[model samples]
Target: MARRTHKGEDDGTTSNNRLELIIEAAARMFDAKGYSATSTQDIANEVGLLKGSIYYYINSKEDLLFRIIEESHEGALRAIATVSHLDVGPLAKSYALVTTHVKVFHDDRVKHSVFFKEFRSLSDNRKEIIRGTGHAYSLFLRSILEEGQQVGQVDKALNPRMATAGIVGMLNSMSFWYQDGGSWGPENIGSQFAEQVVLGLVSEEYLLSSGGRKVLLETIRGELA
Candidate 1:
């Protein structure tokens, strides 16, 4: 059980700002020192609050963690929602999905990092809630892959369900290894990832058409504006 430090006290901060502070602080603490290792006092101290002040904004640390995970998916889901409205082909649409995910994963990376590492800690009840959101995201990817299969762009033999799992597993695993800075930005990293997955998914005929593949990738992989 998590230790109770003290009773909550009023700090006179506005309700909204104080809550935001707690959420952001908790994400950082979770990122820096795994969730199980982090404490209410750690978050309170980070926010310059009394030990119990955190409880004023949230019932428990796990609730805060759940909130973070939910927010982490919000941006990406919204981005993916936009993909359906695009005029692009399956391959370009695939690139958009991958690139949007890359940018979202990196944009609020701390929350995402905590999301990947700490998701298992959620109670089964809460896990079910989060799993709903996860399923929606997975379905988006699967639909695009299935569309590619229909168009003969993706290999007819490919299994969209299994491929979605593999791709999501690969992308989520990056949370453990990808660093904030290096030669690559989200665009480069996302592009390279898209290139690899798209290549593997391409049908033999599609892969053989050098001009077709080259032209499409160059067009879709540009700034997503």
Candidate 2:
């Protein structure tokens, strides 16, 4: 049997189907045309609605931009939050981070790409909101590195904060080029990325051993201590 999202009429919010369709269309158009090149009318046409009707669901084009970026960041935050309080150490936190982050991009290619690529197109105020969300997400990633450094698990030569930003920058770029149903799905890419990052931060001995269990344990302990 088909499940129903609405059991009755007059639910405070309309069915997500309409809003989702609009967002999905906006994501594709923005990705294809660049945010500046894509207009509310374009989104409206794509979704078979009058331009004004878009306002019924969202305030304006900028509002849509905010929604897209906010939603994307929120998704990433949820993933990060999952591991934020985990009993595992920083190294394992990082592994889980990569896995979850990559999965978000793979799950919603269009929305993820917009957040990665078109966020700057938002108005200044909207950009600030997005930036705040982005900063919060970055902090979680940085904390892992900082903890790793403390534990002697990660190399002291690296700056935890800067390294976190760099790794995120690298992974965020994945959405720009990653193809769905490609040879590498989110899981494979996440695993590969996790391995690459762990190697870069941990001792060469750990890198050589493949599983890197020893180095990971050391890193976490150092961080916890």
Candidate 3:
């Protein structure tokens, strides 16, 4: 059975909203102060609720940390899921995924920091869950790479596993330096980042080859089919 959190409210009212607020506040606090240094009361205070009120939503500070990490993962997965279902080929899918990945992180600075940095605060079991989610997302990217290779748009010599890891590492590193205070918007940053990723992964020759086109189409069809 699927586990539901504190409130029975399915409409995202009452308990769900409170939980969202709690998670958001926790993400901010975790980003500002390292997760170990931040307390449940700090999170509760950020949300303008009593510290005891937080227990009604989560069991401990670690749970709140887990929730923040999970939110970013869910956002990332949703972005990938959307691109994975697109009618476009592997190249486009790659572009869309990169674009979404950059935009989501750049747009949600606090969650972005927690996703890349504060995940370590989770308990071993919770850390495993985050690892599983991270692995699944990497596999999803690799699947796209595999499709690209098989269809001929991507280099068959390209190792999807390493390449996927590299791409994620590159993108995630931006959190360390990306300035939300800058004049650049998320769209501009995302597009620029996506272009770099796409350029690195897709060769001009591959884009022109019949094999490349075939592989690209097949990759999308295989994923969506």
| Top candidate, metric TM-score | 1
Number of clashes found in candidate 2? 3
Which candidate order results from sorting by TM-score in descending order?
A: 1, 3, 2
Tens digit per residue, CA lDDT, model 3, 62-87? 88777778877887888878887798
lDDT of each: 0.83, 0.76, 0.76
| Sequence-dependent TM-score of model 1 | 0.88
For candidate 1, the lDDT comes to 0.83
Number of clashes recorded per candidate: 0, 3, 3
Q: What would the TM-scores of all predictions be?
A: 0.88, 0.80, 0.81
**For model 1, how does the per-residue alpha-carbon lDDT over 1-225 read when each residue is reduced to its tens digit?**
854444454445466787888899999999899999999999999888887567778898898999999888887678788887888878778877887788888888999898888999999998898888889989988999999999888888989999989888878887888888967788899988888788778788877774566764666565345
Candidate 1 displacement at residue 1 in angstroms: 36
At residue 11, give the lDDT of candidate 1: 43
- Residue-level lDDT of model 2, residues 1-225, one tens digit each, is 743333222243554787888888887888788888899999988877777766667777877777777888888888878879778766678877887789887777778788778776777887887788788889888888889888766778888888898789878889767888889888889878876777678745444553456655456445544
Local lDDT at 151 for model 3: 77
